[model samples]
Target: MAAPAGDNVQLTDGEERAISSYFGFDCLYDHQRKVISDTLLSKDVFLSTKTSSGKSLCYQSIPVVYQHRQLPVIVLVISPLLSIMEEQVHLLRAMGFTATVIGKDPKENNDIKTGKYSFLYTNPETVLKDDEWREVLMTEVYRKTVRLIVVDEAHTVTQWGTSSTEEVFREWFGRLGELRSLLPGIPMLAITATATNINRRKIKQKLCMMNSIDYTESPDRNNISLFVSEIPHAKPLEEVFGWLVTAAKQNSCPRTVVFCKSIGDTAKVYGMFVRELAGCHREIVNMYHSCTLPNIKEKIRANMNDIDGSLQILICTNAAGMGVDFKGVQSVVNYGPPQELDTLIQQLGRAGRDGSQSLHILFYKNNK
Candidate 1:
């Protein structure tokens, strides 16, 4: 394995050129540069940064740097969402890199076994359930081609992994700790957009990271103006919809995402929006949830990211947000208070990604 350079060493000409040519960036952010340098030096990294903080680049740049040096190294990215995994693969391929998502196609899996791909994107569920894929990963690790393992939404290990109520999460995410055992001595990188101090500690413990370098940035979104409204519990849906419609009209049809607590509520809210818009605006509205078919979910995601597409508004549950990038989302409306502060911060991070002034509205029901 190729070791990382010293922390104080400047990027080489080749590394600088790779960033410029591949990502179209003249220079990396200070944090990105530091993390990449540290990781290359064989350090485990725990990056707890805000959304759009260039965390992905910190890990993404490492493989490119290694490949540029003619060192054969592959990265295994443990992504939580299919949407995020798909987007990462798409972006990497567009940049002329060999990247593929696991279980999407037989040929992709074959490529992994044959050492054809440089980056492999997968989820914990697939890793735990599929024997063939697991075998291929083990083979690659044994051969030392898989140099780094990145856990994208590291907070999920604490949020879902430790949940006493969700057995599926416990069974899948709980087993993530075993990765350290499976491939000892390999550098691990864990990243999340939102995590409290306690959550951060739990993530490191659950992943069994040793002597990890931790990086954190404030979660505040200065470009987003947040507002919370208390409403009557009875018929709160009408108030939420009314506020959203009025806000949309006032904001001149800006891209918006309405988050609900349940899939049923997501569908109901989407239907209500369709009924209310009822014309030209209706074409821009849609809903996304886990229950939605994969093809339809893909379409929804594509449309949301499309700057020119008619689809501008999405009614979704928390399933739509984490690590899923949607540019130019001007507003994020929560149907009610989120169950926790981390979730609220994650949802709010969706908007204002473009650095334009955006809005985050939270509706809280009056207990009385």
Candidate 2:
């Protein structure tokens, strides 16, 4: 498959392409075209698609047409992981497109001026901390320039809807409503790879979307296999550690990922891997839970991307799973069952991405 066209992907009618050149393809994948067409027609769209299924391209194409019209297109993508947002910014910049991330650096007191960025990536926490971001978007300078707002990982906002911070949720909800009101008839696109039906409904209502169309493809990747095993209920940590050692021996330098349910579990798995397997391989094996300091987190993400080997295992909590692309990850070991199937599916999707036969395993201590 050829690389997707640069930001130069042509726009037709000064709005969208004739369903061909914009996507750099002779034709749109049945689902891809559906989303692109619906969004251009001023409809709110929710899409759940498989890994590597061109979800980003759907919303991304909107900016091209909007940009061509000199409408000053701005796409707001809400993602939870700071690392993921940074990675996206890097890609966009590499492609010679203007992208920006607000609230990541407190020192960046630069003007929140509208039209400065074509695509903006941010998290809910980032938005909550910086109320000025919303104000900027609501201002007259921004309203006339901005054409669309995209909510990536739309599920996170749904979780926030019923969170303990009622005031904050109300504020966010109101702001989103105000955004819609401010940019009436401007298209909004919420894209996620995994979402429950209830959460999906909440997202539409909370985001103040009307006549929203939902598009989804299963997260399950059948090319990857699943295995589950139960051990003594005690020492689930020890059980996971032992399994990692064995899995390391099975393949030749396989890139593996071990996902735990919480920050504490991420710590436990990392301790076991470091203490037990340190100095065993030339390839670096690292930990990636959320509690790590910001500087350390940046370093860990950088190292993981540069490292190559089957023995490289990134032990972390659910934080690393969503939209953080890892190429050639050959195995995904769940230290225990995740709280939900969507999580399990997302974590496993990271594996076998290179189309190699990958392994997915779940290990738990047996109670019997």
Candidate 3:
């Protein structure tokens, strides 16, 4: 097996050029170069950087270098959100690379065994419970061709992915390490948008990466201004949004998102907005959560990407936290702060991804 690079820091000039050509970036920034460099040299890597900081590029560059040299290898990405997995595959395909998600398309399990792809994306449920993927990972073919196993949102493992099974869909993230025993010796890359020192240690420990390299970057988005307020606990739903509701009434709510810690809260908030803007609910606001149908989630995602797609304000739970590309957002509101600081940061990072100035306003009643 040609395992991922070891003991090599800087990518070779040729490797760098290939990555530049493939991703269309001029060259890697020092942060990316360092993280990718350490991944090449370490037994494993836990990358803690801010959102939209090209963390995906760190993992994707490995496969690009291998494929550029005509090496036949497959990189497996374990992402928590189905939407993000599909979005990742689409992004790779647009870059002229082959990528696919397991259990979500016309893809067959045999395709994985045959090495018909350069990248394979799957969620934890597929990894742990799905018989086909579990079986495929044990195959001689996978043992030989699979080069790296990447956990895209690494902090989730420490937060244990959405609190619990009933809370969100990331519980499998903490249990991800069990796979290391199944595919021993395959270098792993765990990347997250945010993690404290304690969170980082827990993540590395849970993933069986105690010996992993650590790369840390400031998880700050300078373009976005953050504001916190303690709203009256007994206030009406309309008081929460205040003037933003007026904009929703006028069909001019700048692309905004309200994130709730729970699905029930998300529904309540969505109902409030729908009641307040009954006629324009379809045009101005939409609800997203773990229980939302896949097709509806896709539609909501599409609307977010479309600047004029009508649905501007998104009412969602942490399900929208990981990697749904809702670019061009102008403001984000937290109905309340999440239990984990990492979750709040991830949720806040969703705004201003396009580098536009944005706002992250948290309305709370009590101390968290």
In terms of TM-score, the best-performing candidate is: 1
Clashing pairs in 3: none
Model 3 C-alpha lDDT versus the unseen true structure: 0.81
lDDT of 1 by residue, 195-284 (tens): 998888878888888589999989998999999977677864656678667655554677888899989888888888888777666777
Model 3: number of backbone collisions: 0
Give the candidate order by descending lDDT.
3, 1, 2
Worst 10 residues of 2 by lDDT: 1-10
Q: What tens-digit string does per-residue lDDT give for candidate 3 at 186-275?
A: 878998888988888878888899788877888789998999998776888888787788987776677999999889999898888888
Instruction: Name every residue pair that clashes in candidate 1.
Output: 4-40, 4-41
Worst 10 residues of 1 by lDDT: 1-10
Q: Residue by residue across 42-95, what tens digits does model 2's lDDT show?
A: 667888887778788776666666656545666777766777788888977776
Give the residue spans of candidate 1 off by over 4 A: 1-13, 140-142, 165-170, 247-251
Q: Report the number of clashing residue pairs per model.
A: 2, 8, 0
Candidate 2 local accuracy as lDDT?
A: 0.68
Q: What are the root-mean-square deviations of the candidates from the true structure over C-alphas?
A: 2.7, 5.6, 2.8
lDDT of 3 at 4: 39
Candidates 1 and 2 compared by TM-score, better number = 1
TM-score of each: 0.92, 0.83, 0.91
